[model samples]
Target: MQKKTIAVGNSSFIALIEDQHYYVDKTACFKPLLDSGNFIDLITRPRRFGKTLFMDSLRLFLAINPANPGSTAKQERLFNGLKVREDKNFCDKYMGQVPVLFLSLKGVEGSSFEAAYRALVQKIVDAAKMHAYLLDSPRLDEEDKKLLREYQSRDFMRDLANIDYASSFLKNMLFFLARHFDRQAMLFLDEYDVPLAKAASRGYYNAMCDFVRAFFDTLKPEAGLVLNDRPVLKKAVLTGCLRVSKESIFTGVNNFSINTICSDNVSLSACMGFTESDVLALLDYYGLSSRKQDVKHWYDGYRFGSNDIYSPWDVLNFCQCALSSKNPLEFKPDNYWIGTSSNDVIDEFLGFLTEEDAERMQTLIDGGSIELQINDELNHSDIRRHQSEDFWTLLLFTGYLTIAKHAGYKKYLLRIPNEEIRNTFRSRVQVRFSVENRSFAAHGLKLAEAATRGDVGGMAKVLEPLLKNYVSVRDTATKAPAENYYHGFLSALFACAGNRINDFQSNAESGYGFADIVFSSGYGTDRLGIVIEIKRTARPEELLDAVDNALKQIDEKNYAECLRRMRCRKYYAYGIAFCGKNCEVGGGTLREV
Candidate 1:
């Protein structure tokens, strides 16, 4: 099969189609949304789940080109071969029939309220420029034209940044478009809650809220509206990661409909992410059908409504990487989703971790689910409180956690979604433990020191307490070998030494085998090296035997040959074994290379 070009980061609908990039046909979602008859709709999904791309497709499908109002030839070509084009009646009635005001608040963020308010107004100016032709439309009065010109100017945008001036901005923009097109405008507000989330994180929530609440209130219909007495908007759809409560942002707005991860509407739920069939078809097209199970293990645990979905971003990225590899079958899957955005929210949430929460988190890391009251509608302020429910809710919406099942009213079982997200949790937990308890780092360095001095009992003393108190891994749900987890824990502990250790290597090839860890520290004559081998057992009684076996392997396999190669005059080799939290340590006498 021929490979279609995977546009890994292209979110524009027109660009994806015109550039001939591999496009997932989500155009089918357009019909239901248009036929719902609801004046306003809010759809929330996790970040990078293709929400932006979905909204762009909707905009391009419905928007009447300001430059050529009489023709949709360009859009017709764009939608060609897509699933929605199959519906002739739907296409004839709605496609390219409406004026669309597409505004994204995703980039409306700053360190302070003033700066963020400036960004918001700048976005308004950018949106208005798209309709600069409205200034020349004979249907608009001179006063409306003057306002449009002012909105498109940077000088006027500076003045409009204030809450009082910006409050009526959207209403007036819709009115101008309505007059130009002789029809009420459709509004697509993407990432609508981004400003508020940024504001909350930066300690300016109230000021931003005052502006957002007033700005969004324009969606409501008023009895005194002119222009044939039609409401300013024919329809409005807002896409965001979290659904801010109606009482907060959408105050007084009637006929509002929300589709979230927990929504009962299966169609709406499947709209944002790739369904199983979508993934299978994409993989088959890319000739990666053999790797379907590997692909699912990393990125396919997200549950949206009644459908199981995969992260479109991750799947496309994985496919792109696989196709680029010499042997696609041997290409290992990676955590592509975590690197796209800040995992600081997870870090912040983990900072408030208590003893009970840590245990619960470990259970989640072990592939087990925990019951929590899930609230899909949460504002940044609710997240700021660090309540358990709020944190988990944020996690669910942000794609770190997924719903395993519903337990009771408002209660649901949540687990780390897949291997990619589980790895994120594990790394974050390690950092959280290292940062929150400064003594943990001290103990970690001391453990290394003990291992370097061939003091087996000292190494065991430090390892046992840490393994018991701070380790986040156990018999994971995937049933991966326990040795890898123990190896990771020891590597993380040694990693905390930072600059003190000159070099640290994990699973580096040595004389005859791959050593679990080999590191060199100090300088000149004082330079020293340490070699470690980690093992895990199911029963405490087997810990000593595991430790002895590890020691034998380190010697027979010449794990310390790596230390000698690193030019360390003196080196120490040790073996550590773990059964749950308890551990045993063994080592040979310190030796010179």
Candidate 2:
């Protein structure tokens, strides 16, 4: 089957139509938005979920004729056969009827706050360039002409001083647009939070936040300002990933109707990710209906509000791969989402996980859920300074994990959404852990051998030195920064033995509950199995008690039941306790002492 050309990163609604690219008609979104009457809406969604494309759709729908300012003939063909055509009233009311102030801050990336700000300023300048006709409009007065001509000034790029003083691009652009069109302007901002997220990761969050807020501050009425002096922004729409608490970015703006995955309103849920109908239609179109369940198990687990939506990007990429395969079953799912973007959230947060956090992650990775307090509103700074459930909130916001169950208000039982994210967790841990000293990684063999015979003391000695350097000492277990460091290190050790690590499960089901870490030597009468329970203690004095408790839990839980059922020759269960730089290992056969 020949695959239709996918608009992977193409954000142009017009281009998608003109080039006949494969697209899901999200123009239905234009109605609820029109009915809401809320203009300054910030629709937050994870990356590659059609936010940018939607922004483009809205721009084309509202934009005055770019080729002929007095007429909208050219833009009319762009929406041919789209969903918006069903609503004759909406089409007559909005299609290319208003002046548009469009700006996309998605490409703004830099090392420092100033550099990023410069790039953002450049984007603003380019948006003004898109409306160069505003300057030539006979309706514009001299004051507006001065403002529009300032945009054409080449020296503005080098003049950071002027940009710093008067840099509300949205405000100035809207002002000029309103005057030129002799009516209020509709503003469209795509990936509005991209700069904020990038700045947070780059250590310029506060500065970027201030700039962002300052820019938005112009959108509202200021003190000592009359109706005439107010911002020209009428119905403005912005799209990005994080909502970033009202106290953080949208501090003063209360008019915003934010639609996130957790929102009570399900109207925009289908608008974010591809809905079930969308997946079904695409599969049928591509002649891959037989593999629907397989595709669902892989790329279709994300929950937005109350709707289940597949990642449009992943689904398209899956089709791209499936088109090359002779059979749908032959094409396996991979981390298609992570492949196109940086895993900054995963990579950065892994370094801060506490013993408990890492343990929870292990459980989630092994197809389990962990309870967490989730705040739908979050900032990038919260991610860095946070030691609590906010980490899960950020991950959920970014689509790495989804709500497995909502326990209560601001509380959720989260788990990895599908095989793609699960593989990412495994791969990231492997990279972060296996890159340490070769000698330390080599110790995994010795550690594995000791576990085979349940040499508790020997295993403790091998891990003690490694923990001293790798363990992050949190006064409590709620936040373990070095949780992944040691867990990954230990896993890497077992992994060093070639295919032997294939039998390892960090939290595998066995007796009644689950085992912390288990290693089985395959199904053989002579083979041996190893079970280890890990516990973290805040004080060295508690190490012994912790080890004792772990061993008792292992016994009580019957963690070796699975291996025993497999008819293994014998299996060993060991208890390991960690306290800062000290550790005490226990449990083994009666003779191993």
Candidate 3:
């Protein structure tokens, strides 16, 4: 494979440049659409998934007919030997008979729905004028001529009241063009839900939803009149990230079909870019076979239904890096997917944190699943009702989290995609969790450090302060329960010190039952394991009994099986009993056996 210049930031360049290898032949995606001859279809795919490139490919293929009036002879040369060239039926029936109204809604990010809706309509109107220029027909009725002039004027608000009504203006314009050309008008909408995502995240979901609902209403059956010998509206293909389910936004559209990530009808994965064979061949040409598995691990888990999809954006970036560098690992890790959204939205969602939620989050961090119940109507108004799974789903769809697996039907278990997300989440959680319990964290840190070093005196010094300040309260009204404080203190300790010296497991399965805290660390040539038992009382005899019970459980359950499997030179299990933060270390004596 020859090294091709990967084009960036230019939509036109992606479609027309084949000699320079700037274009990948994804014309295979047009097969189903062209075969079925559907007038309108909506496709929902994540951002940077080649929606723009696919639309541009369609534009080039349609720009070649004499009936279309803008047939550039040079543009016809661009599609030679492409997938569409082999389709005899497509060439005869649809190659150049219709005029296409192509528009992208990707650039309309706004502070509110009204502002964004206005910007979106302006873009569509501008696209209409550009198409009109391509048509170059001076002959028109007064009403058609007026519509064209009004479109050029760009005061779409006067022509249409709301975003929904705005689509009527577009439909009318397309209707007129089809009649003028004596052909059906084909509509290709790219990144159509961008405005909706922006508005929903910026506090205008309902307004945005209403606008989109009205906009799509124009495509309803018998909504517009046919003009000249042309069909008023012939076909449309709309693509975006979220499906915005018809029950949610697009109502009353009886003939439309949705091509989504989970759709059985569309092979959206291969529609975007290169196939697996293409990737392997490229790797072999570039001598990157060794790094192929690593690349797949990071970017290959995206599943569009059962057909696993790879991010075309990442694949391109990787190819560019491979061509430019001798070192295959030179590409820097980046959260490229999440960079499209504002950080404030992520921060705002993280702001609603509680201690219980923190504990649950820790379990998830350690590879546990969280269940979230979904309701009938899921909208921005009920955003706060979102459970952990809802937030995880949002993160997954938005690219913060990647779907690890589909657990049954609707349940999607999620995990951080790469080290970038993992590290970012870890830092954010540390700051938030530490802010509310600075002093407690400090005290717990001291105790954990001493326990790691096996210094009984140093541990007592820290334990005394915790008992006095937090655990010494006898009146239930004045303080939290002793058990609650113990759990919290242990959690803070594990969080702050576990990464450094101790391997602690909270609510992890042990021999007979789950253990509260099992701290293990290695010394010069030996290993030490401590099983901590927390209770409400600190009597000497009671402490001894608790310690004996913990040791017996450890023996019964083979809790040290992990250490033994690792073939440690030595091991010891110490049981420490705690009451209201005060603890005494007494357990079965350390023996070589």
Highest TM-score scorer: 1
Candidate 2 overall lDDT versus native: 0.73
TM-score of 2: 0.71
Q: What's each prediction's clash count?
A: 0, 4, 5
Candidate 1 residue runs with Cα over 4 Å from true position: 160-163, 223-225, 430-593
The parts of candidate 3 lying over 4 Å away from their true place are: 13-21, 37-39, 64-75, 134-139, 155-167, 228-231, 284-287, 326-335, 338-340, 343-346, 351-385, 401-407, 413-593
Name every residue pair that clashes in candidate 3.
39-235, 39-236, 164-214, 164-215, 511-557
Worst 10 residues of 3 by lDDT: 372-381
lDDT of 3: 0.60
lDDT of 1 by residue, 445-537 (tens): 677667666788888788877776766543432477778777877887776554446579998999899999999865555578888788878
Deviation in angstroms for 401 in model 1?
Answer: 0.8
TM-score of each: 0.73, 0.71, 0.64
Error in Å for residue 545 of model 3: 56
Q: Give the lowest summed-lDDT range of ten residues in model 2.
A: 221-230
Query: 1-593 in candidate 3: lDDT tens per residue?
Result: 56556654346733347546556567766767756656678776666767788888877676435344655454447777777778777766666556777778887766555567668768867876675653456545676676666666667553445334465665776776676666777778888777776766555778777767766665765665666544477787888766566676666666677765545664444676345665666566556767677566656655555565666666667667666776656654344444544544344344344556566566555655544332213344344443544444455555545555655666555555544445556665445444455445545556666775667567667766666666544532236654456666656655654233445666656555765566565532444565555444545457667766766766676665544433344445556566544566544345332
Q: After superposition, how far is residue 111 of candidate 2 from its true place, in Å?
A: 1.4
